[model samples]
Target: MKQSTDLPGLIPVFPLPGALLLPRSRLPLHIFEPRYLAMLEDCLKTPHRLIGMVQPNAVPGRDESGLHKIGCAGRVTQFSETEDGRYMITLSGISRFRVQSEVDGFTAYRRCEVSWDGFDQDRAPISDTDCAFDRKVFMRLLDRYFASQDLSADWQTLEDAEDELLINSLSMLLDFSPEDKQALLEAPSLGTRRETLVTLIEYAMRGGEGDVMQ
Candidate 1:
């Protein structure tokens, strides 16, 4: 966990599509590639242990359009090494940042200068009372969507999740494309993200291809 004032101006970035990490959520990643494994080794030497998880932008004409402009930074929270030399780690989402510029570096992975502007609300505390939703309606739609993808969830657990947790978890777990996932990631707030999620689910049901809305 990093203090707001202590957030780094630059951090190593992991450019993977369909891997979204929202603030306060956890994303587990398998580090096997030589570059990312090296990235983990370097990150472990730093106290903050922060990594920027950004998705490659499929859209064109943006400066350095290889990656999205916005992404969330996460702190290494759990880690273990396998006998096969693979590293498994979990990242706890810290904050969202805008890419100011990509740093030219000798390291195997990419790094970026980021600005933590307009996302101060990510660090705010979330309470159970803040997580209200129309589950009856959502669950019904989810049931149909899940069946189409041959998936299922512990409805009881989902029903018990905090509003932020529910939305963020589903956003990360759903099998939407990079474009759809980016929409959820760039949502201005929780309420707006929820609306986007519902709209995506509705879109998927209407023939947009995607897996379960996990």
Candidate 2:
């Protein structure tokens, strides 16, 4: 897939805590809410079918105060509309972005002015040689973490997957706290993300208290 040269200055955002999208990864979303359904309809008419995936700072009920500054921009790669006016869509991550400012919009869903200056590297393919990731230690820690959580994965498939996919997929799929997931999303490099993931797993194994995904 070719990288998008013309990333938009303004983007529609979906702020769901603990839901993560990393560059070159894919996230599947179910759009049923009226505002989001409208957002999707509007996005589908545009040339750039992009949506920003961000995490809310506070839980949905407590406050509607704010969202984290960093997020990943994804393009709608696959979409299906239901007879009941719902959408099941898959977004393929394009790049990571920083929220420069919020742009007030007429739509019920929020919009933001984003800057991708620092995350240009996200536009390129990340290879195993790109960073010093300790795969051996990561796997060991992951094994222990999985056992403790009573989670099972297909080891053969995971081991065969590409480095970037393995790291980002695990980061998105794991049941980490919103803060931890945001931390993973904001990690500057693949190596840094791998290390942070290992640390989180270790902390969980040590009985550290944190909120699980609701």
Candidate 3:
């Protein structure tokens, strides 16, 4: 088990809008960009194998920092390279960090110094049983949300998923805007994320357009 202190303070960041990687969740990524490919190669050489997944700030004309303040660090768990040199990898979320500042370096991709305070719980995986999720009610809400979006999901798989897994995966896979997804990623806890998830669904069902009310 990696201790919190073992977490790296500096990590290469992948600033992809609309992408959310919460602690204990898995995100599959296709790495085709030259910078990200270099980042991936560098990560494989490091012992931590961590990559920070952050979103571009949502506000228009706000390019002060370009990225949101918070992001989740993911450990590269699965990786493979294709014949065309593209890399396929899966990142397992480790913890959420607040960006301290961008690090200027020779690397092509962005790197940041991140502070991992107040996210100690992320270091330890929560047992699926600890999640106080009411699957039945949430499933009904999800059904309506999915139907309204004209999207289909494998019912059996969703039924079999662990509580945290279901919630986090939905948060990442849903077609919500980058801003909405960032909200889900920044949620303080599993239960809170679940609440935020439900609220977003209800808002969408009601035809609430951009910038969902918090």
Question: Listing every candidate in turn, what is its Cα RMSD in Å to the true structure after a full C-alpha superposition?
Answer: 3.3, 3.1, 1.8
Best by lDDT: 3
In angstroms, the error of model 2 at 106 is 1.3
For TM-score, the strongest prediction is 3
- Model 2, residue 149: distance off in Å is 0.6
How does residue 41 of candidate 3 score in lDDT? 93
Clash pairs for candidate 3: none
Q: What TM-score fits each model?
A: 0.90, 0.90, 0.93
Off by over 4 Å in 3: 58-65, 128-132
Q: Give the alpha carbon lDDT tens digit for every residue of 14-103 in model 2.
A: 998889999889999999999999889899888989999998886488767688899999999999988998899999999989998889
Q: Cα lDDT of all candidates, in order?
A: 0.86, 0.86, 0.88
Q: Which stretches of candidate 2 lie over 4 Å from their true place?
A: 1-5, 59-63, 126-130, 211-214
RMSD to the native, candidate 2?
A: 3.1
